[model samples]
Target: MISYEWRGHFENPEVNALHAEGFDHAPLADDWWGQVTRHSLGWVTARRDDTLIGFVNVAWDGAIHAFVLDTLVTTAERSRGVGRHLVATAVDAARAAGCEWLHVDFDDHLEPFYFDNCGFQPTNAGLIALGTSAPRHV
Candidate 1:
């Protein structure tokens, strides 16, 4: 069984490592990730005993809108409703914080997961490429 919490303590390395496995982002120094999670409106984590398994962050503009960022669930834990639970927790937190809108941006591959599983409605969105896909190799 997995448990969720609105936690304040987020240790890097553990988190960066979990994120690397979950999100496929190259893991490096976690100083930046620590700073961001520390300042987020809310952060949710999933744990089984002492192991860090999943995480997500909620960012608000100090108004009626809140965005869900970095929704991650380890590959081993995927397709087991863990992602949906994380999103639901964030949504409830946002509403409790007086937010009227819960916004999320995800890839097309996740459309069914977020929309069908998590109950998010379809909407037109945009994306931009900010850097080269294949940086010059050495």
Candidate 2:
């Protein structure tokens, strides 16, 4: 069974290691960890048998909208309810914070999953991010 907890206890290297295995961004660089812990509404992790299996995060202005970030489940733990649970947790947090909307910028493939599973739907006009120019490729 999976269980959820706020505050990832990043001091635990195992938790950081697990994230490395499953996420686009991982291993929880010190600056990233500090920023997320300091700026996000809260961060959550899912665990089974003391091993971190999944995680999600909510970032909000603390009074309005909240964005879902870092939603991921370890390969070994997918196909269970971990992703749903993470979404549920974010939803609850957003509602509690009096957010008018919970927004996510996800890959096109996720539209259906987010819509059917999390009650999210495309807006008549969705958001866009514009920059003067793309940053130099690493």
Candidate 3:
């Protein structure tokens, strides 16, 4: 069975590994998960048998809005309700924190998952690139 934590400690590198496999991104920065903890209102981690399998980051604008970011699960654990559980935990955390809105932005391929499974509504949104690369951020 999968277990979860509303954490007081971070598993930064392990979470980066999970993110790398789950999102098919190149290895993320070793300290990236640290930044997530520093910025988050709260986060939830999912595990089974002491191995990290999933994570979700709940970041806020310090007012009424909270965004769900970097929801991930190990490739072997996908479609097994890990994503759903992580998002649900994040949403619950956001609500408990008194956030008035919970938002998420995801790629097209994940629309059904976000909409059908996680109950996010479709809305008009936009993105603007302010730099060629976030080279400093990685």
Q: Determine which window of 10 residues in candidate 1 has minimal summed lDDT.
A: 31-40
The numbered model that scores best in TM-score is: 3
Greater lDDT among 1 and 2 belongs to 1
lDDT tens per residue, model 3, 10-33: 567887788789778887667855
Quote each prediction's TM-score. Answer: 0.85, 0.78, 0.88
Q: Higher-TM-score candidate among 2 and 3? A: 3
Candidate 1 lDDT, 50-86, residue by residue in tens: 7777888888888898888889888888899888998
- True-vs-predicted CA distance for residue 75, candidate 3, Å: 0.6
RMSD of 2: 3.9
At residue 59, candidate 2 shows an lDDT of 89
Instruction: Please list the C-alpha lDDT of all candidates, in the order they appear.
Output: 0.81, 0.75, 0.84
lDDT of 2 by residue, 12-49 (tens): 46546756776556576445467677798877788887
Cα lDDT of model 2 overall?
Answer: 0.75
